[model samples]
Target chain A: MKVAVVGAGSIGLLYAIRTQEAGHEVTLFVRREQQIELICNKGIQVEGESMMYDIHVKNIMDISGAFDLIIIATKQTHVKKIVELVKVNEIVAPLLFLQNGMGHIEDIHEIINPTAIGIIEHGARKLSDRTVAHTGVGVTRIAAVTMKQEDLIIYKQMLESSHFPYKLENDWFEVMSDKLIINAVINPLTSIFKVVNGEVVNNPNLFRIAKKLCEEACDALGKASVEYHLDRVKKVAMQTKDNHSSMLEDIKNGRRTEIEGISGYLLKRANDELPYTTFVYEGVQAMQQMDRREYE
Target chain B: MKVAVVGAGSIGLLYAIRTQEAGHEVTLFVRREQQIELICNKGIQVEGESMMYDIHVKNIMDISGAFDLIIIATKQTHVKKIVELVKVNEIVAPLLFLQNGMGHIEDIHEIINPTAIGIIEHGARKLSDRTVAHTGVGVTRIAAVTMKQEDLIIYKQMLESSHFPYKLENDWFEVMSDKLIINAVINPLTSIFKVVNGEVVNNPNLFRIAKKLCEEACDALGKASVEYHLDRVKKVAMQTKDNHSSMLEDIKNGRRTEIEGISGYLLKRANDELPYTTFVYEGVQAMQQMDRREYE
Candidate 1:
């Protein structure tokens, strides 16, 4: 199967390399010419505790070709731009979006192709332009946004391997919200405190704040009857203890964060009822702004 | 006039030296004998923009003998301990309590003698054990907490000078609350962001959070309707932009913050209705804990 992964970030690079390694024709769509040139010349490097390999794949600057599967592996903030690019280029394929929050779910409706959403439980970090550190491996859950089940089977079968596991779910909202709750609790707390995920639980005061944020998030999502548990959030934090959350990474790199999609989305849904959520959301936003200024 | 200033922190040293400079005999009551020895031998150095001078005021480890004016220039966290010392020592004098929050206001009730509360607007930094840098000079507002008008007049006359200006107010609660609202907004934000006070206003997102916090605080203090403006808070931040807030300084130095007296006090008074206040309060508490652990 031929696949094109948009955005050459950590997640995008990881998927692009892994999919190519699984005997599929993969092309990485990157923004910077330097990144494209670097990847094309040196290939992609994947380093981890158990695995270390490099895979050479075609890199592109234009979304001009049709593929069997199109993975939108950009941050949620860039999803809209990807959608616009795909629409203008008329690249019709089975679209799968791997983003961190629920805000991009609505944007999926704009895509006319069969669309699917994915949550990457694995932790991957970009070491350089063409290098990604596969920090941890976990099951990737994929669900249909507007895609037919029969259409997803081939893509799933093509992408899934013993090393790269994939699970399919019928309810994408639950998958996104479950991940949203976890991100909402861990991301901002770690970013605000400038600590690793583990510190949020190891530090008693931070643990309490995390618990309170989890409860507030759960209460806000209660109106939708979204299935969530504070324990599940804690469990995720514990599992990713040493990992810097994506939000924290964004702040460190002076990049815009997915806070608008995660906490900001929750704040919007909360509609003035979740005061704690509002406070955390605004506080993280302020920190992000400060981070950007420091880089400037 | 004979005055005894407790605590050898920046505020205590500033007041003690300034009072002595005004021709009044002042004694500094310090906890450690080292601080007393350092002050007694080196004297208290006041470094300012235009002038720098050292004044020798007797330092004592024990609180003995009656003082015409007793100024408690300790952090709010130490007020309870100071109150106990005063009670055990049975020193009956016109007591002036200089603290940052409203928590100590209730503790003032335990003192039987004439009591007054003060908010020091000046930005003073402790350069060393026997040295203080008067960063900025502002008016110190002194209000009678449980003191007679005539007694406050004499005490104010004794303490006021060209360098150390003092203003008298009828209500201490208003003065403390006014400062409380400012500290509640500025201190925690600066500490959390690890920025000087000016960043809280210069950064748009931080400024927004500051305004929101101020509004929430005003809402929480509904009955008294404390006279506070967000602009006043911003002005203070701008003026103290180069100086780390006392809370930030405390966090940086690995000392316990007066958060319990500022945001913690407001959180208690808010009665769980102020969710934003609770969130900010708990978030800062967690950061403080994290900071302490790093030093440990």
Candidate 2:
């Protein structure tokens, strides 16, 4: 199987390496020419292991070949642009988007490719352009947005290994909301507090705040299964205890956060004002501009 | 007039130094005996001024001599215990408590000494045991919690000078509520985000969070004048632009914060749940216990 990953982020790097290790031909398409050079030179360094894996790399602009599957591993903020790039490149391969929020995913019914959305339970942190640490090893769950669920099984098989498993969810909305609520609860908090993912649940006071975020996400997204979502959030938080949330890493590294897609999306979707979500959305936003004195 | 400030904190040191400079006999009472030795050896250092003022200092445990006025410049958490010490010492001086929130100020009516509560608009940060930088120079407003407002004038005169001035407010509830709402808005955000006071208003994104906090505070405290309070918050934030909030300084210095008095008190006072307040209250509380990974 020849797989093309659309972004050279932590998630993209992880998937590209793992799939390539499973004896599948994997090509990682990065936005920058410099990144391709970096990857081609340094190969892909995985944490806790000495050998850097040599994976194929290409500029996203020069995406020239057909592949078995295309994984959009960019942030939720980049979904529309990536999809537009996909359409222009005339690549009609089955597309799997691994993003945080349900941003632009539901609206992509008009896209050319057979699209699917995935919720990656694993945590990966990119140390550099060509290095990614697979911090937490968990299964990736995929649901077909435009593709049939039966057709997704083969793509899942192509990506899964003995260590990296893949599961299929029946409903795209259900699966995405489950991931969204958890991301909404944990990501902003870990970023704002500079705590690890598990601190959201393990720290009792932090857990109380995380519960409020979960409640707001549940209410605003119109999820009736509150109890189940809350339990799932707790479980994932505990599972990824040591992983610094991507948003937290972004803030720490001075990168633009995907708040607009995550909590900000929930704020726009809700009928009523989600105070807790808004607080965190604004909290993270404020933190971006924080400590730099505007006047004297 | 002989003035004794019961807490040798920033506020206490500022008041003691200023009163002594105003040609009033001033004695600062401190908790730690080491603080007295530090002050006795080094005198008191104020920011922006080089000359060290020789202010008298004594341990809080000994309240032997008589004084014309006693100012309780301790934290809101230490109010009750400080008031008890006043009773135990039997030094019947006109008492004035300078602190944040309405924590135990109203309850001090049972005390024998004529008591007044003051809202110190000036910002001060304790740099060391006996040194405080006067960050903002706003007038202190005194209102009688148990004593008559007419009777507070002489004590105010004793503390006021050309540089340090005090004002008398007819209604303590209104003035204190004004301060409480502002503190509730500014303190937690600055502490959480680690920003100075001005950024709460100067930074537009931060101002949004500040507005939500202010709105929730006004609603929780039953203040119908929303627009007025919001304006006051903005004004105070801009006025203290360069000053780090006391709570922010405390958090940075790894000291205990007074979240319980400000947002915690408002949470208990409100009939309905204050999500914004709870989020920030738990935010500060969680931050206190944060980053200390519990398991693994």
Model 2 per-residue lDDT tens digits across residues B128-189: 88789998788999898778776788777766887888898998888998999999999998
Cα misplacement distance, residue B258 of candidate 2 (Å): 1.9
Task: Return the number of clashes found in candidate 2.
Answer: 0
Write model 2 residue lDDT over A1-296, tens digit each, in one string.
Answer: 88888798888888888888888888888898899998898898788878778888988878766888888888888888877777787888888988888777655776868989888888788788988888778889899988977789888886788899999998999888878898899999998888888888888888888888888899998987778888999898888777778788778777888888889889988998788899889889887766544312
Report how far off residue A119 is in candidate 1 (Å).
Answer: 1.1
- C-alpha displacement of A92 in model 2, angstroms? 1.9
DockQ value of candidate 1: 0.55
What TM-score applies to chain A of candidate 1? 0.91
